[model samples]
Target: MSERDAPDQGDAAGPPRQRPRSRAADWLRRRVGHRFPLVARLAWDDYRHEWLVSGFSVLALAAVLIPLLVLFGLKYGIITNLLDPLTENPRYREIAPITSGHYTPEWFASMSARSDVAFLVPRTRSLAASIKLLAPGSDVGRIIDVELIPSGDGDPALEAADDEDIGSPEGHGEVVLSASAAEKLGVGPGGRVEGVVTRTRQDRLETVRLPLAVAGVAPPTAFTRDGVFVSHDLLVAVEDFLDGRAVPELDWEGSAPRPADRAFAGFRMYARELGDVAGLRAELLRQNVDVRTSIADISLVQTLDRNLGIVYWIIAAISIVGYCMSFATSVWANVDRKRREFSVLRLTGFRTGDIVWFPILQAAFTALLAWLLAALVFFAVQGLLNALFAPTIGGGEPVARLRAWHLGAALLLTTAAAIAAALVGGRRVAQLEPSIGLRDN
Candidate 1:
């Protein structure tokens, strides 16, 4: 064959003449180009055929994971909600004397004086023995002092709970009945319940049963535990019984019971703020008041606890690595399926550079679709979880809105992974022997 007719070498002794670059080389030259939407569409069509292999592609599986994400979001929602009530508001500690023997009033007086003590709600415990309850077969149980809270700072809920509401004297030996207690006693405001409570100490027996006029009923909170609260007067009565004394004239009922007439036991103290709880405890120790809050080293112990954000970074990194692997495997499989297409392109004078871009385009489209789906799904999950659990968990806020940076970061990382996978496929095409593609085995 003439030199001009040779096929193996670059075009008829190319060094002999100055010639423009081959069409394939020229196509490979870097240039700003329009985004080829049609090229991407074609690649996506080719990639979609693998769905015939049954089971979802990685991206499809991620999209279907909405349920799992919803559950995680619920847990996150509830946990985040509880923090609002705890971190934003004040909490308290209820204290009682450690009865090495019995708490003296002096000890109570001392603990009440502490700076952290929001209120030294004096309280006493007493059992009812003499009064008969309206409920068949059950006598009245002991009356315990209801710890006074500072919340009456002018809330109508407090005003509505007058002595009649509590079913006790308006201001004196008054006490509130629990809903079940009032029902069992067959009493409303102005009605009476009589019961005897007994507390026997070595060789000492005290029976306290007084007719208690109903004042009001205690309110119920869904989260609240069972208990009852009585005015400080009833507590004083219990204290009088404990001290082996009874003033019958004062025991008489009606609203505006006299303060001097009402009785109490040894004092019980509490503080509204738990932050200085330990310090108050130490102060109580100095004052010889043995009552206190959690003094153990339990809360001091350490755990991962965000640990400088290291664990979070590790989790994020793992997620990114997983994304890359899925993206690469998906793109590679799609590229491999088009091996014959690429072979045909080479023969048609289409540069392998252009051919390799098909897989890259597929990677980009799949990531974009998955990302948009994830965004919509995540927000829906956030809303649903907040609706279901936020109020119950006692959060200050429902849900924090997702930010723009989050979407940008996800897209950037995802797009970069797709590009990386495409480049890997491109490297293979760039090095391919076109003749090998054309040869018969």
Candidate 2:
């Protein structure tokens, strides 16, 4: 037959079909629609027949994940408990003067005017800060030297008191003892004590005794050392006596003392919030004033939290690598055992990609079961640890807890690792030749 006139073999068969533009998408959809149910059924059959090996894979994953979750929970709980009080208490956020300076009244006024300054109190001279306390009209009198710190309105360290309790003695006569100081002096609220303040004047040290009333006792946590809190007015009185100047309220007769200046050694300042502490300190430093705050401790705690998070990620990575290796090995062995089945499926017109889904689905199911078991194990361990160690380590709080995000992350990581491992095994299964089934048949 002439080439053009002869019966065309292509025409006799049929017209050539054109492939779709999105060949990959059409192929994937066709394979998934035809084989997903078959893959699911095969996976279920494998799981039921190979229950022992499947359980082992789940247990293996749980072994690594459970301990990681527990350690993370414990560290989070312990650190939070240790830092809660320091971070929550406004008193600990105080900025105290580190060096003595002439803090004039104008300087204090300006500082107090700043929006960041919540409270401002001046400190007395250290040398002049010491005072001798004696209980009045009792053998309970014990000569004790105490530091006198400045306290006034809005002092967070001082407990709330009535107007009478906080009333000024008009001199060095009203004082609030710290809990430790009060215990040592055998005094409480509404008690009377005498103070013998000594100062140097005209190159001679002189003693001036004055009467004081104990208005209240501050809590033990208020101060790190034994001391007494007095209003700024009382502090001025104590300073006058230490300078050997006559204080009329104490009934001392001497040359009229020079008018007290507005200058102070330093001032104690409080920021409006913890977040403002660093800014306040920086501003004070720029003004050439030395300041101190608990910001250093807060920074340290935050750094530790960040480091722990890094450690957690490192641990998770290691665990995921280990689990992937384990899951891949198990799936590979199972595929090797079922090579003939995959060969038969391919011979029956199943595509390599469709056959691959069998093992992938099985791996996914295994990961799901493992994650469930791991969650159960985590909760059990959390309860056990909280019961065993909460009192000593967390002050009766839970020592371990799994936050929702943690659980979600764990599940996602495990499932992704399982799918990846299964894909690796699926590549091996896809390489099997359909001829193997025919030969075996």
Name the 10 consecutive residues with the lowest summed lDDT in model 2.
161-170
What are the per-residue Cα lDDT tens digits for candidate 1 across 110-180? 65576766555444543431123332323544343323321212111222322222222343344455555
Q: How does each model score on lDDT?
A: 0.50, 0.77
lDDT value, residue 18 of candidate 1: 74
Clashing pairs in 2: none
Off by over 4 Å in 2: 1-76, 88-91, 159-172, 200-206, 246-261, 272-274, 306-382, 388-397, 401-441
Report the Cα lDDT for residue 123, model 2. 80
Judged by whole-model lDDT over C-alpha atoms, candidate 2 comes out at: 0.77
Q: In model 1, what is the error at residue 390, expressed in angstroms?
A: 0.9
Full-model lDDT, candidate 1: 0.50
Candidate 2 lDDT by residue in tens digits, 1-441 = 334554522223333784343766557656665356656877789787888888887788778878887888877877787577765566657888788988887888888898888888888689877788778765666888888888777776764332233332234567888788888788888888888877667887778777788877876777757788887777877776667666676576555754766587877677877667888899889988887788887777767878888988798788888778878888898888888988988998788877888888888888788888988988998989999999987888788876799789878877888999999789989898899898975
Candidate 1 to truth, TM: 0.38
Q: What is the lDDT of residue 403 in candidate 1?
A: 50
